[model samples]
Target: MHLHYLGHLPPDDPLDGYLRFDIAPQLGVHRTPSGFRVFQFDFCRDVYLYEELGGAFRVVGKFFPPGRRMAPGLVRPPTETEFQNLTYLHRLGLNNGSFRITRPLGYNPWLHCVLVVDHFDGQPLGEVIHQAIRQDRRNRLFRKLSALAEFLAVLHNRTAGDWTVDFSHPYDYNGRLIESLVEKRGMARSEAEEFYHLRENWRARTCMWEDRRVLVHGDATPSNFKVGPGREVMVFDLERMAWADRVFDLGRLAGELKHFFLQETGDPWAAEPFIGHFLWEYCGYFPDRRDAFRSITRRIPYYLGITLLRIARNAWVDWNYRRRLLEEAKQNLRAIP
Candidate 1:
């Protein structure tokens, strides 16, 4: 879980009132939406209390980079729209959901640099599931799983094709997006030819495109969500929202549901009984597509298997927090039929 920090390096967005440096803000004079302000609102969540006051909020404030303890290096400032888009994407959620990953609270169009979404809230589904299992209360497990399914259904229903990003070569990977997925996740590394052939072989696993496509929230991990006071699942942060494979999106949900179910039961084989029930419940919203849905179902093992492998690969990079993860990864692998 490396949060993308592309916002800190580039042209600073004067519109967003962002300044670049490793300087931690002090309770001092910094302009706000109003006027000169001594401090900003206080944030109390995720084990940290951050109040902006009396200083410039640098791009690299109170954070250490990956390999270095000193701090991230200085960089060129951000441009106008570049900065604004970052803020808009981040704060845009405020208008729609309870949270936004905007670069800065304030806007400064003059400097282009903006912030990345490092914000993680909402009890990670994993943590939430773990606590429930520890307390021997898996009653709401199905309900929560259904809730997540609904969220995915909505997102998959809206995946658009027009929207594009800079890095991705859309011209190259349109229909073959699954191939890209295979390569990106390192799931089909048997050989280059084998991976290519496998990718070419995977047909559109689902007929989710029968109705329409809007926007697919690319990443829907539990950590990306946050539960409001009443446990309302407010889906926020559309950083990866885009036109994408409908099966890919739903496949992810199936994999997650399988992981949680197997975790609670500790038996990979026990997953099948509930899986049919879950799929039935999931399709209640996006009805009349059992064939497409089941295609994704059968492939859940591939997705889940690759996902577990990725965890192992990530663990080798850093051993400090491997125990809890290693066990889960192995369990996921075992549960993958």
Candidate 2:
């Protein structure tokens, strides 16, 4: 293999050997690579590897930050969890069809916990949203949102399981975010307390537990999904994937749409039509679409509120914007439906 570095390769990096010796066999590339290039995407964290010959292979390697553990004494690393999640979903038939995901190639714990997967050539959905807002491409945005809605609906419906929907996870998650706002972001304790009580009210709603658990993307932000030229949706970032209420994904997506519109156009209501369309499209995948729509809409507000609070925790967001998010979240939480 005539390996070339287009970006910095860390000292004593073993990635070349890992790809040549471990990943090559799985890819059926018995022949030596005539030429190869590696480009670091995010400093030392992500790299794009390309083989000019030997079938012109291309893959992205993601390196998990060291010292991060799922829990005390848990040997399972984030790399393993993500690889297993990807493999699990792939086996469930998400590797092809209209809805897809980056195919997991391999993972090397020795090489900085690098998880390798097929490199997707698609535009990030976030960028698409930006284009839609800036260029007034409402039709294009509608089509993409429909595709995403279908993708998520299929994922949740196919992965529905016997496990019960646990409200505790979301309750704790929201509480923690509020606490962080008060403790770290200088949010008033009274405001945080009010949010906490509102969250508690949501927890008491029996509608929250009506649905069976399904595998949710966990992080359904626009940046985590990509839209191909054919408008196919491919979701990634499965590190947060878990069994939860299906709306966990939908509401986060809705929250993102609302946030983008508010930030870009200074109109929160601008996203309402699209959000309605997205959720309505999602309901189409169910046997009783109307019932599904009614049930999901009833529960989506809580998750949307949670997503808003989650975004508010980000330090990069302007303090005023964060406060607005908190207020929006409060209104959603206060909804009786």
- Candidate 2 overall lDDT versus native: 0.82
- Encode model 2's per-residue lDDT on 1-337: one tens digit a residue: 1224575434355777677667766776787554456665642334456553445577777776576556644467767788999999989887777777877889878777889887767788888888888998888888999999888888898999987799888888888888888888899988988998888888888889878999999999997899886658887789779999999999999999999988888776888998999999999998999999999999989999888988888888998898788888888889957
For candidate 2, the TM-score is 0.91
User: What CA RMSD would you report for each candidate?
Assistant: 9.7, 3.5
**Regions of model 1 farther than 4 Å from truth:** 1-49, 52-112, 116-121, 158-200, 203-214, 229-231, 257-266, 270-278, 287-292, 295-306, 316-337
In candidate 2, which residue ranges exceed 4 Å CA deviation? 1-12, 34-36, 42-55, 69-75
TM accuracy, model 1: 0.51
- In model 1, the Cα lDDT at residue 226 comes to 50
lDDT of 1 at 138: 56
Best by lDDT: 2
Report the Cα lDDT for candidate 1.
0.40
In angstroms, how far off is 121's CA in candidate 1? 6.2
Distance (Å) between predicted and true CA of 54, model 2? 8.7
